[model samples]
Target chain A: MAILLDGKKTASELNETTRKRILKLKQCGIVPGLAVVIVGEDQASQRYVRNKHKLALKLGMNSVIKEVPASITEAQLLALITELNQDTTIQAILVQDPLPKHINEQRIMQSISSTKDVDGFTAVNVGQLYLNLTGNYPVACTPKGIMTLLEKYDIFLRGKKAVVIGRSAIVGKPMAALLVNAGASVSILHRYTTEIAEYTRDADLIISATGVLRLLGAEAVKPGAVIVDVGQNLDETGHLVGDVDFNAVKDKVAAITPVPGGVGPMTIATLMQQTVDLTEWGLANGK
Target chain B: MAILLDGKKTASELNETTRKRILKLKQCGIVPGLAVVIVGEDQASQRYVRNKHKLALKLGMNSVIKEVPASITEAQLLALITELNQDTTIQAILVQDPLPKHINEQRIMQSISSTKDVDGFTAVNVGQLYLNLTGNYPVACTPKGIMTLLEKYDIFLRGKKAVVIGRSAIVGKPMAALLVNAGASVSILHRYTTEIAEYTRDADLIISATGVLRLLGAEAVKPGAVIVDVGQNLDETGHLVGDVDFNAVKDKVAAITPVPGGVGPMTIATLMQQTVDLTEWGLANGK
Candidate 1:
């Protein structure tokens, strides 16, 4: 059987480090604060936000959720973001996805201050990531978390062949940038990519974020390949699953991350860690 | 046996369109203006700036060269950019690269206003390009010119396997992003990459921007593959050459671009077109 890259265990270790860092900041009279703005009542978004709030409080940080009605105008949303930008106590600001249809999502994202953009969805942060700019800047949580996992596992990426089976701005694109910046030859496959196996079969590392159940199988992956499944889907039996057919490919691969216990926990852990990072950066820069 | 994707002919066509647009803007009492800022007395930089000035005037646009001393401090250079940013008549601003070692290049790039960043090195513009933002932001001239070439030739990118060699921010990275955004399976190879032929041999379209002489030879390319050479190197015989071995690969490929007349001329043409675009955008937005 392949070695399991346990996300739950890794996330717990990281959360412990974050807790200590939060304590140090508290002793220095700086409480890390995160504000999550949600428009309308999205059950999934609500669950995600609640989990984040719970974790932030557990870590001794301040967390608040600003719930706005679906009827909020774009102007009102912009004003709210501007207010959050000026709020001295709020070190990190995240406007949850799936805002009301009328609100221009990109414009709302642009309104968030880049420094406090904990989600790292702003154009400035995205651009800096692509430019490989040095110094401190928040990165997209999912990809940043994946990098942490790769580092912890001591997977050297230099000159490796990495195939990313998605092209989303959130996960796939940023993940490819990170891998390429780390000296890996990166290929991005998307909906328009024909014969995806032709690329994946030769990959040293395969990352699937396509959200399709069992999209990656044993036949598509080379033996001894490291697999990271970023997909969360419902199987035919209503069980939570990932993009990879983990059971079928586990014995053939060198290492693999399980669906529920893999990348999911790392996302929340990264959010908490970035919240503290943003707060510390804000303190150092006197913002 | 292969077709020559003539850059000089295509660039001339684009230049004519840009000239007509400039005349239309001029009749509307708006003259497209570009300011090329250079530091020190580098012969290559001087020649490049001179060519740009000649092209701008030929297209009936206002162009100026602001030559600063090499000893200028970062603050002084930034102040000059600030002045240019506030100048109403200047619609596009370009800072020639290879500033003195003392000046931080990234800081200097960030100093230019995004609206007038004709070279598209600014963080906002680079970010917009990666995000595939719509509307009127300038793109890096070389990549934009390459895209124009692809479009003019009616080479559809959808579902194609494209390989881009080199990862410099100016050309390789942005070019890969553009191809990925256009629905091509894109791979980026750099100095760290091992056995580049392993990827290029299967590519439907190969774009080489590495400054190495004849990097993509007959052995590395497959039969009937389309090649675009973005490299400009001086051969041992004192003649300009590109990354591809043109003579060797000429009959083996479906189409190819030559060195001096391929990507080079398109750079200046795209810069002129962006100048007109920036002026029209400014008029529409009342900037």
Candidate 2:
């Protein structure tokens, strides 16, 4: 049987570390703050924001949720982001995705200050990640969390043949960057790929972010390969599932992250962890 | 026998277009300006800068070569860059690589304004390329030139398996990003890579940027694979050569770029092309 990369359990452990770091910062008269700005009433976005807020509070940090109207102009949102950028208390800032159609999403994402860019969506931070520069910089939470989990399991990344099955700015691109920085030879596959299995079958590690259900099965993957399913999909029967066919590939794979208990929890935990990290990094630079 | 992907001929064609663009700009009362900042008296660096200056002038653009002593401090160098950045006449800025050991290179590279970042080394521009954002942004020249050459030869990138050897910020990293953005499955290999052939043998396109001479030969590559060599190394006999054994692989491959006549000329030509592009983009944005 494949070793379950229990993300839920791992996230709890990470949250504990974050909680302690927050305590340390508080003792020094510093409270790490996170500001999550959400435009429109996206239930999913709201739910995610609320969870983050609750977790921040639980970890002894200040968290603020900025709920804006769907009619908010791009300039107005940019002004708001400017304010957040200058706010000394807010060490980390994140604008929820899926802004109204009128607002330019790329412009808003790039407007966040590189230092307080909590979600690490800014081009500057993305560039730093891509270059693999040795410095303190926030990365996309999901990919960062995945790296943390991989490290926790003592996974060897250097010189490995890995395949990242997506090209998303949020997940796949950053994930591939992280893997490459860890010295893995990575191939990023997307919708245009002719034969996904041609790459995946020989891959020692496969990270699938494509929201396709049952994208990989036991027969498609190499035996003993490690799998990380970043997909959050719903089966026909309404069961939450990942990109990998867990039941079919479980016994054949070396390790696999279960959808519900895996990447999702770690992502939230990493966000809180990075919030404190940003605070510490700020303090180190005497901000 | 494989066809030669003649970058020298392609670059000349591109230079013609760039010259025409410069004429158009001049008629409109605008002169595309290029600033090549070189530090120290390194012969090779000086020669490269001279070539750039000569080319910029020959192409009908304003060219400035700023040379400083090796003893200059980072602050002093930055101050010079500040002046160039503010100079309305200057549209593109390139700080030559291999700055003196005392200088912190990354800071200097980052300080270049993204709009005038001709070499596209800044984190913002790299991020833009990595994210495949649609807008006016400069990219690293060698890779951009390689892309242009591939397009000139009508080489299809989408769905092709490409292996980019090396991960240097100047070449390998940006090259891989370009290939990925163009819809090719790109695997980046570096020193830590265990088996270079493991990826290269099956690749439809191979871009070798590793400075290792004769790194790829006939036996290791797939039949009829397209090869783009970015290496400029001296062989054991002190003859200019590329990473590939061109003679050995020429007949077996579908197309190949020769050592001296391939990537080198394209790189310089692309730099001139991008300088004009930056000027046009800046004007459109009312800069």
Highest-scoring model, lDDT: 2
Q: What is the TM-score of chain A alone in each candidate?
A: 0.97, 0.98
Residue-level lDDT of model 2, residues B221-261, one tens digit each, is 99989999999899888899999999999888999998889
Error of 1 at B189 (Å): 0.9
Retained true contacts (fraction), each candidate: 0.79, 0.81
Model 2 chain A worst lDDT run, 10 consecutive residues = A113-122
Q: Give the C-alpha miss distance for residue A52 in model 1, angstroms.
A: 1.0
- At residue B21, candidate 1 shows an lDDT of 95
The per-model DockQ list reads 0.83, 0.77
Tell me, what's the RMSD of every candidate? 1.6, 2.2
DockQ of 1: 0.83
- Single out the weakest 10-residue window by summed lDDT for candidate 1 chain A: A119-128
Q: Judged by lDDT against the true structure, how good is candidate 1?
A: 0.91
lDDT per residue as tens, model 1, A114-183: 9999978888898899989988998899999998988888888999999999998789888999998999
The per-candidate count of clashes, in order, stands at 0, 0
Q: After superposition, how far is residue A108 of candidate 1 from its true place, in Å?
A: 2.2
TM-score of chain B of each: 0.98, 0.98
